[model samples]
Target: MSTVAVIGASGLLGRALVRELGTCAGWRIVPTAYRRVQGDTVALDIRDAAAVAAFVERVRPDAIVLAAAERRPDVCQHDPAAARALNVDAVRTVASAARQCGAWVLSISTDYVFDGSAPPYRIDDPPAPLNAYGLSKLDGERALLQSNPFGCVLRLPLLYGPVLDWSESAVTSLVPAVVASQAAGARPAPMDAWATRYPTYTPDVAYVIRAMLEQHAKGQAVCGIAQWSGDEPMTKFDIAVRIARALSIDARLEAQTASADATPRPRDCHLDSSQLDALGIGRRTPFDVAIGEVLSAWPAPTPSS
Candidate 1:
């Protein structure tokens, strides 16, 4: 069986990758976590080049999935240096080490790499990032490609999955606001209606990655840049409405039609996943179904809830 090393195994996507790949019949899993290290998880910081190199040399995985990054646009804008350290520099470090160890690397990127001015972005589309987060990821993509020509860059859009806290993901974060807005004499909560996002489920992404690794195990390596995103497009308002519906609540949400974010965000950077579809590598759980599953985990808030 081929061994796969998962970096950032505690994050949303990393956890899913561990669960899906760990259960696969043809693969062994080596997972690492930084802040939330566990008994079975290996502790390794991806930012330290020597540490990453040493870890890769020790594990010598057949494939490495990089799901670690500072994905917050506001954070990236405030601290471009920090974003560069992880998103760009660390990616180069991993790719360099993976190439040395003859391991295939799959680095996660974002649809924010595009300006979102265009619709259904193709793999070959030119990138025009309007924010620091997107810029750093674009650089990371280049770094990985330059280090290992055979490495793959998997670009994804807004993601939401099982989370320890409602604030953990953009989608779930709106839960509290929707609930709070219905409080007695409470004002309507303003929700962003400008930017459209495809909230992909992490487990589904994990399944797709497994397929990618499986093909590579059969000597059919996927190289260069690729993307996978949920085809359902919804703005923040739309998402909150669905959440409210699932919870059987009359969520008081005021649609904010204009962009008010300090950090520039694309209006609609819809990614075309026909590339993955053609490979027969894809899964998309409807937002309502997936959201219900996620909300079911947490007890409904009090009457104020």
Candidate 2:
């Protein structure tokens, strides 16, 4: 069986990857992270070149998925050095390690690399990042490509799903906030922004990775750049309203004051997944259906038995 290693296995995306891989055939996972998780974990920081090299040599994995990064734009803006260490340098280290180990590497990236000036960006478009986080990711992608020509660089948009822990995704963090707001008599607010974004489900991302892995096994995969996102494009306001509707609540949303400084969010960070779909690798889930699924899986209140 081929062994796959996830560097940040305890994260939201990492957890989803692990769960998705459970259903795929011919692969066992070796989950590693800086912070230990409740499984077969090895303590390794991707920023430390020596440590990363040693870990890769020791694991000798057939494939390495690098999902660790300082993902917050505000945080990256505040601490550029830390972001470089984790995002750029760490990626370089891991990519080098993977190249040395002859392991196929897949690096998770973001749409933040674009200024959001162009909606529905393509994979081959020239990247011009507007923030430290974006710059870091762009640099990481370059490092990976330089380190190994046969590695995959997957650029993703907004991601939503259950949080594996506190240090997971912001989209995951919004779950309880919305639920709590509803519990506190706060209804969903409507948004009227023309700007839209593609929110990729965590499970869908894992599925793409699995497909990419299978293609890699067949030795017919291209390793340049691939973009993935939900098929449907909707404004933030639309998503919030949909979530409320999914909960069987009245969709009562109002457009709030919009500002550009709201976490450096792109006005329209949509992606073109036509090529991905044509390759039989993309699965598009409607926003309404996804919201309903998310709401359905929500924890139910327990009654005293």
* TM-score of predicted structure 1: 0.98
Q: TM-scores of all models? A: 0.98, 0.89
Question: Which residue segments of model 1 deviate by more than 4 Å?
Answer: 300-305
lDDT, residue 252, model 1: 86
lDDT of 2 by residue, 115-166 (tens): 7887778988878888898999999899889988869889998887665432
* Tens digit per residue, CA lDDT, model 1, 149-218: 9799999999998888887799998988888887888899899999999999988999999999988998
Clashing residue pair totals per candidate (backbone < 3 A)? 0, 4
**Candidate 2: where are CA atoms >4 Å away?**
165-167, 180-194, 260-263, 300-305
Q: What is the lDDT of residue 220 in candidate 2?
A: 72
